[model samples]
Target: MAGLVAALIVGVGLWWSSPVSSGDVHRYVTEAARQQQIALNDGSLVELNVSSDLSVKPTAGERRVTLAAGEAHFAVAHAMARPFIVTAAGVSVLAVGTAFSVRLGETGVEVLVTEGRVEVARDPVDAATSGGGRPKLGVGERTLFYATNP
Candidate 1:
């Protein structure tokens, strides 16, 4: 019993001290009442709206995020090699160095582009394999994808 307790304490210490790991463990940013801002490892900035939930997964080649609820604004760093992607509902919004906002509503997911351009696709895997050419949205453009649409 003493040995087990010591091992558990060591495990907790390791988990607390390690900020970056080899595995692609997702980091989360959740807001309940007020807006929250977070700076990502790749120089991207995220502004989470009230009652929003966002999970970030950074891999060797890509930066990925999932918008679970509410809305958030993303200002991605300019990196052509590493694309930034946000998955909400069944849609994927892909961008490289752009500013955009994603809002999850009761009926559908809405994507608004304020700067640069973004691509919206039904399947992220297909979007990646197909050169991410499903449908592109430019600045001042937006799209809504209903849950029943895809």
Candidate 2:
């Protein structure tokens, strides 16, 4: 019992000494539709869906956002210091100074590249956990990755 207490104390101390994680994981995020302009801390704009949820900011060096279950249009600010990554289901859209829309649904995922270019990566499984962007998609291109043939 004494050893366990000591270990717990040490773990707590170490955790307190460590820096905070980069991203802020927010679920069930929402706002008005007609407005269609959500501002980021860095002056970027994201027009979200009626009731969409996503996570943002994984590290100080980069701006990462996850499309948990809806669609979002991004008007990204030009920041080479921070690359924007939008992960929806099994697909991830990586952009720097681009604008695009990403949607995640029960069928699959779709990415409509409007402005800049982005990479559309596929997942072997029905869900995605960890992987980098691949298979680049340029402007005016739309790519879809099916989860179960729909």
Candidate 3:
């Protein structure tokens, strides 16, 4: 039984090492005058407004995205195996099979979760003033943290 198990493990490792298929997490749309929507392999959809930049990376470990600039709406699909993470400005939002939208600018940041739940973490903009890094965001809520000194 031990020898058989070892052989099986080796076979699985070999199979995993072989070439595998790939899929795009989200499509990149830049400098658009209108709205842009992207459908992902995980059934999630992202809608972007004008003058925006968003990058989606769907991998086995984690489904990551970045809203570099502008506004975007995310309709994340249900996936227990992987979690969805979005980072914009100095803030990071994490979702577990939920839908939400995020808008970031020089003023601050905004996050709205339409379904499921999400976690928001504050970015360390200025340690001297704010004391430390970003704040922790809870589930089923929205918050706007100012970049001002306390």
Candidate 4:
């Protein structure tokens, strides 16, 4: 039917206009004593510090990054509808149009905000072992999260 065809066309158009239409995974890593900078498809920028590992996956609704090790700085793009979330060592840092850095250490994770604000929360799985409450960090603010069991 013509109605069905029109609806299908609209759906395809919407999908094409999305920030990230496909589930593509991007990985970035740095060697010892070296640093790397990455520019994401969504216009965000990431700086990986020495011996760091990072992965980025932007879905239709959110831009997510995982810090497997070391430290990285994020200069997030302004996407109000899609929040930028960085996860490291059971901690999640959520930001919108902000800049910050996250570091994973042997003891725990550290977050430093240089611009705007970010909300830091512990993953549910690590709640029992995570100490301290959820904190919102603004410019020039920083926090360190330590595992209660560690």
**TM-scores for all predictions:** 0.78, 0.68, 0.67, 0.76
- Judging by lDDT against the true structure, name the best candidate: 4
Considering summed lDDT, which 10 consecutive residues are worst modelled in model 1?
13-22
RMSD of candidate 3 to true structure, Å: 14.9
Measured with C-alpha atoms, the lDDT of residue 78 in candidate 2 is: 81
**Could you give candidate 3's per-residue lDDT for residues 17-127 as a string of tens digits?**
332333664446545445667677788888887767677777777778888888888888877667777888767777767788888767777897777667677642221
> Which stretches of candidate 3 lie above 4 Å from their native place?
1-27, 123-140, 147-150
lDDT of model 1 at residue 34?
Answer: 59
List the global CA lDDT of all models: 0.80, 0.70, 0.69, 0.81
Whole-model alpha-carbon lDDT for candidate 2: 0.70
For candidate 2, the TM-score is 0.68
Please tell me which model should have the higher TM-score, number 3 or number 4.
Answer: 4
Question: Per-residue alpha-carbon lDDT of model 2 for 59-145, expressed as tens digits?
Answer: 676777877767889988888767777878757777778999988877789999889887667643111222244677788999888
lDDT of 4: 0.81
In candidate 4, which residue pairs get closer than 3 Å at backbone N, Cα or C atoms, i.e. clash?
A: none
- Candidate 2 — worst ten consecutive residues by lDDT sum? 124-133
Better of 2 and 4 by TM-score: 4
Candidate number with the higher lDDT (1 or 4): 4
lDDT at 52, model 4:
83
Clashing pairs in 2: 22-58, 23-57, 23-58
